[model samples]
Target chain A: MPLDTSTYALAHLRLDGRRWNELRRLHAQISTQAAADGSSYLEQGNTKVLCTVSGPQEQKGGRGGARDQGNEAKVDVEMNIAAFSGMDRKRRARSDKRVQEMQVTIASAFQSTLFTHLFPHSTITVTLHILSQDGSLLAACLNAATLALIDAGIPMSDYISSVTVASAPSSDQSLDEMDPLLDLNGLEEQELPFMTVGTCGRGPGGGEEKVMVLVMETKVQMARLEAMLSVGIDGCKQVRGILDGVVRSHGKRVLESKVS
Target chain B: MAPYTGIPLSPAELSYLHTSLSQHPPIRPDARSPTAFRPLIAETDILPAANGSARICFADGTEAIVGVKAEVEKTPSASSHSINSHSINGEVADEGVRGLGSGGVRDVEDDGMDVDGGEDGKQSSKGRDEWLEVAIDIPGMRDDDALPVFLSAMLTEALLADGALKDKLYINTRFHWRLYIDILLLSLPLSYPLPLLSLTTHLALLATRLPALVSEKDEDPLFNDDWEASTHLYPPTKDETARQKPPITLLVMSVGENILFDPSREELAVADAVVAISVTQSHTNTTGPDADADADADSPNPLHLIALRTIDPPSRLTAAGLPNSLNTSAGAGAGAASQSLSSVEVAVTREKDQGVSVWRPPRGGVKRAVLARMIKMVVQAGGVGEEVLGGLRGVEI
Candidate 1:
């Protein structure tokens, strides 16, 4: 039988000290490349990603090919986990399921925000190289990809940020009352039935607005799904504000350099 | 002709060519319509670090990025004899006859076009035949001289055709206001059609945006005794010139019997001949007196007008003969079998008004229809339209 929901729910919560709803600090840097069309480096707590964007170049291949004439642009995303990135060893290969999932997820997240049709028949590839993984690897990857795209000066609808939340199972407790954690690390991730939500816009509590782009639920009870989603969604809003600040400051630096 | 060495033409290729022509009465693949154009997209200022930059992405997945950077250099004396020599700043010191001399309109006519007639006229005569050098640098790629030559010629043609660098704007042509454009390509499929693949080339140009020179007054004249000395005391202020937007080229590729808007890598692999056409818009600013009087009241306003046209001569398969009809349905499958048996003659007339023709090997019965249809597809795919097709029909292939 599957592990008891109650046993894993908030099983590892350190209630006496740190609050369950608290989030880990996030940091990001932009304009990391001299040659690429755009480049950025982002780190959320322990998860880290380096992204590089190139092209709006000629469509490769023979003439009259799709990239030859129209406004449709192509996007290629590659995500690789180094052997030393995680606590456990990672094999040197692209066939891993986790890496593939990250690639698709990151690509999908950017695709929704990017005005690809404006580029018609052309391709823009976003490469994400994961240097380290703690927890919320997907969230970090998404954040890094967004920043890199902005640095590349690729136009976008808005920025995307992601957060993870764990739900404490208690039949006696109201679903809304369940403690919502933010930015789960590997240790927290291993012990809780959490969900990851990537949102665009700001967060509540006077932060940034939020628009949900992706959601991944891991080992959460169906009954507590709504409660967990709200928690994750709220946490994502908070993260978005922090990421936006980073982007703004970075932009300021770039502008200053141009001025000076 | 036997397939070029190991490059064997597939049977499917021959059959597709024949079938499309016979069924649809397709237009000749080589005949392009005046208005029909391949699609194009351009992004400017793509490289912020570069002085000027642009990227042109075509539908066929062929893309090119061009970056332009400018540097200051002392004007070389030897270049005075060059075709564009008078354009050099120090070489033409006499500004009076040349409006560059600080004289008003009347002085301009008297000196600008006549004073240096002997030297300027010689330069003007040679200008028509002069060639500008184009250099291309691709990181880690083999040096392909043909690519640079083709790209440079196309760029020069576009600049002239669009009048982007009219004589007025490009005043300092002699001092080697070299524009360096670098192109980087990320995706180019091997089976890519020539026409479409050609579109991915990116072009970026850098030139000094010199402000209009104005005369300045000199206060301290104790050391300057002569009128020429006082006049030379004050020089025009040279403001920091901002980089202008780089010119963009939109490439359109036509393939197969049909014109696929933007074919992907997979689709390009199967296509026959491809044609890549670059289109740029020319903008001309009318400021001088000569321009004002000649401007017609009833004609469309020419101020900052965009004139759209092709940049370079469209390339085609050299060995193929011109097609006889725009309609391809004259014959059927038998045409492919008989293509090897027939011999044809071809005469190339290199004029814009003269149409290009591709002659297929003669076939009997249904084969004729197939051959005709195949040729039709090629012409239509080449962006040729009804009028061009009509013209092609009038000519012997």
Candidate 2:
């Protein structure tokens, strides 16, 4: 499992046969669970997640009681990993520091992107259940939650889309030849040091995107981080387009049903 | 009643429940008998990454999943001596750098030594408690919250009560298996979830298996390539009939003269007392009933008590019945001053008709008689403990 560039170099294709800057096939559906206020199911390659949004309701007896005194709705995230979701059946404790950290990261990412002031003295809970994990787990959860929130009809400043990018390992030591890979799968993720980048608010005339969420768990060369980040942001923009299309089409169907 | 109960019930509602439960044959809300549990959907050996895993869902939509993971960890004692020597060597190196009198070398050496020393300090600091870890996660609770913290501590205490599990973890002189029991509660805001969590943990532990060690005991433990060769953590007896397994805790609630098992949220709202009893399959009671009589005996095994404790019902924390002294005019605007005045008058009229009311939290502490009944229900043969252990044993892998 060391990054052996020889095989990838033979064909400019990644382990999954995708080229540089290519993304895995992403499939998403909104309002999947009728019981939830807002719910969505998303699949990126082998990574799949189901997200539900419940709230903007009264903050019951919880830690949010103190912090919610401000004029903003607290965004709470609860992430659950199915034991059968990964290559191995691993059960992540709800109190796991790593899982809790991811939950905090997702919560804070939306806390800034959503229009929380509109619903003060309340809490917006986003619960994510990871059905399958290939790679880019955190990124997939973010995208799934965004869709579910939109379905919940929660107003947000912009769509927060996330993707993973990694600097390709090269035989030569030159940094210029190091091409960054976009939307890596589980295998590539394990072999390469990658970062998950979430972008919000499309740049005016598509100039630059705002980085709302940037998380890198593995160490990589500082010079290569910029390359990986830029690629991830571009991937997020591409993801946003796909998510936008889904919402618009679903809206069209709803409109047609109403008119009839 | 205490306010912690997520669901609020009116005084009339609480009274009706208490009166009904006080009857000779308690009429449960769900119509289940005093000893009957809510129907549950359960599955075992469902998680691939875990050595053993189980998921259980109650009729009320409460779901709990437990995973048992075991990793071969190097015993710190094996490396503690080496770390001491390495630290001594670092000190010698530090002195050599200072004696050189070169600021460049001293700065670089100082930073490296500090990092090494820090890591060394942390490594040797961990106690024997590092061998086993148990964590519980409920959706809305923090890791340090009283409920999750207490649940984790109780689970750990029950697992280590007999020290058999720890002994099973011993791999060799240099290494041992580190066991992680991770429990996750899917549906949250539950008032009493201890029984659900404990049941899931019991099923998961019963299904757990350890990779067969192909390497010699003195050498680095090597696992066999064939996963089928793996052995169950709680294997059956030599006869391959009855299995030895971890303990399971049951939540029992008392209402007036009746003791209810697996009580629901509404039932707990008016409960007089609640207790959790932990039990494990007995090893010494081999001569117990039907031990030799039945050939294909799938009969319930004898269980021994591990731990028992009373849990405060969440309903006691809720605000007592309405018509209190608190005023409703606090949030009324100036524009609605006259309107608010009229509303206050209406409230006063109703209060006069109903008379002044005062509510206090339910009394604490369990009666000694109720406590004895709770224990008997769990530990007595053919009781709740036996029924649960037998049910898990019948689960098809």
Candidate 3:
């Protein structure tokens, strides 16, 4: 709640004291599930997500049909939202439309990045579980998936980092002076028009320069569209920096234990 | 969604399990006795997010996690009907719901799910028994599938039979509590699932807490802010019968000729006949001018048999030697048992008084001795119910 109505500015950009460009505080870990080939748990503020990657293994016969497609092993994505994830208990069926849509979004995004030609006639499964929700559900899922894929030692073109940027209130309080809020949370998300952008690590344009991997927006005002995109891409870059740090630290730790 | 068919066994393995269970002393692969229950490891209030929660694990690789969430809802009848609570409150002592029967043996007929067959306890209006909702989710099965549906129905029926939930959850004439109990069968053993499911529901309901209603004025209900002042689902006291017991379903497995309780999945596979019986104890009030009550009071038999149900078995059994499934006995209450409860029916009811109130017995003949022993074991399990109440009392959360 802002004190001065005249200013029309938010007292703070978010519930947490994050600058317009500041991403939520994130903590990521890899290789947590021994049963799955690769797994990662990511917590951004109060939002928690666990991603497990299994496969490049034998595909069950009859399901895929005739080893038809010569290359490009199919990737299956399953997303489970625990009934207790929300404030109110809501049980979603296994075949929920929303869950299936999310799965397709993730599968298609990774289909372009993962080196599927390496493992033909096989399948890889990515399962994402939402343990808790604060906001930016889609972006958090993508971030967790990237780490899990890396942990599984899957070959990808580069880190596929994503973030959500929403139209935020400006300090000026003028209707015209709107700011883009990075990493929208459950509260801000419900009110603001936001966009989720997934970007690759390297430069934006050229061969594989098509750095923009995914862009999902639900009815946005045309005027602020460009701002949300720029802010979202910048947020993704910052996220990539954090993911790079985790993977490097994980590698160093593994090497240290092996030497010891 | 991949079908989660749990632990499939081959024919050879099935035979191996059968041979082991049929042995003279019952040499279980896990070395358990005929009546030995798997050691239960449990904790309650772990899921503080829910109003109340409990998790129980067993050695047979079965795990049940239950969470009871209570929501405050306006009682539908409260607005339209000024239920004559005032009249009933004075004459009908809270504990005097001693059930409806005046002591007569009768075969419990399969009166369908809504059997009004309780003779002695206090009868709350039939509509009040509608609050509890039980759902079971085993990873591999669909929510609408047969296994989960049957398990949920059995759990809800057993819990509702005594109307204990409605008793404790009633807040005021205008308001009441609705409990949504979710039983997550995280893992199912190869055998009977009722015992684990029942125990989990029992412990979870015991750990349930409802807000304390403290009103400054008479008309509307207000709640106290202190969580410590909240009350347990079952009132804490010496007179346990003042409330209904959390009904538990026990798996009765017939191996060769021996009757076993809480058989593992392997034993369940090869057992000649399997029956999962839901049992709860009602009061056998001796204070009433009834000869049967006096006889029972004198004989040291005070526990009255409440609701009994039989679950379908996994395999077929030949029914030549089995006891009648619809053995109602006395506790089928007076309201609905008018047609079934008769003096001429006294002999059959007396026979049922040996305490098997299930709908149908297992296919193969269970000797008279074995059936009698089964009832005695069920009755004896009631004493342990007190220990469970005590255990629930110790749950910190």
**Top-scoring candidate (DockQ):** 3
TM-score per candidate: 0.37, 0.67, 0.66
Candidate 2 chain A: minimum summed lDDT over ten consecutive residues — where? A60-69
**What tens-digit string does per-residue lDDT give for candidate 3 at A154-200?**
99888888888888657765666778889977877776678778887
lDDT per residue for candidate 2 within B1-397, as digits (tens), equals 3444456676667767777887999998888889888877888976555788888877776777787888788876576533544586543332221131111221211110112223323322222345777888777677789989999877776676534466578777678888888887766645488888888987888788998988896698888968899888887665434667788888898976689998888888888888887776654333445555652555544565656777888657655554433434544454345344566775664456342343334576888777777777777767887777666656666
Note the clash tally of each candidate.
94, 13, 30
Candidate 1 residue-wise lDDT, B171-288, digit = tens: 2323322333344443332233333222322223422222222223222112223323321101212221111121333322333334432333323322333333322211122234
Error of 1 at B277 (Å): 49
lDDT of 1 at B286: 24
What lDDT does candidate 1 reach at residue B282?
13
For residues A1-260, what per-residue lDDT tens digits would candidate 2 score against the true structure?
A: 77767778778788778998999999999976554678888999888887888888877666634645678898999888865567554666677998999999999999988999999888899999875688999999999999999999999988899999988876564766688999988889888888999999778885356898999988888888877887888899999999999899888988999999
Task: Write the candidate numbers in order of decreasing lDDT.
Answer: 2, 3, 1
TM-score attained by model 2: 0.67
Cα misplacement distance, residue A130 of candidate 2 (Å): 7.2
Q: Looking at candidate 2, what is the lDDT of residue A199? A: 94
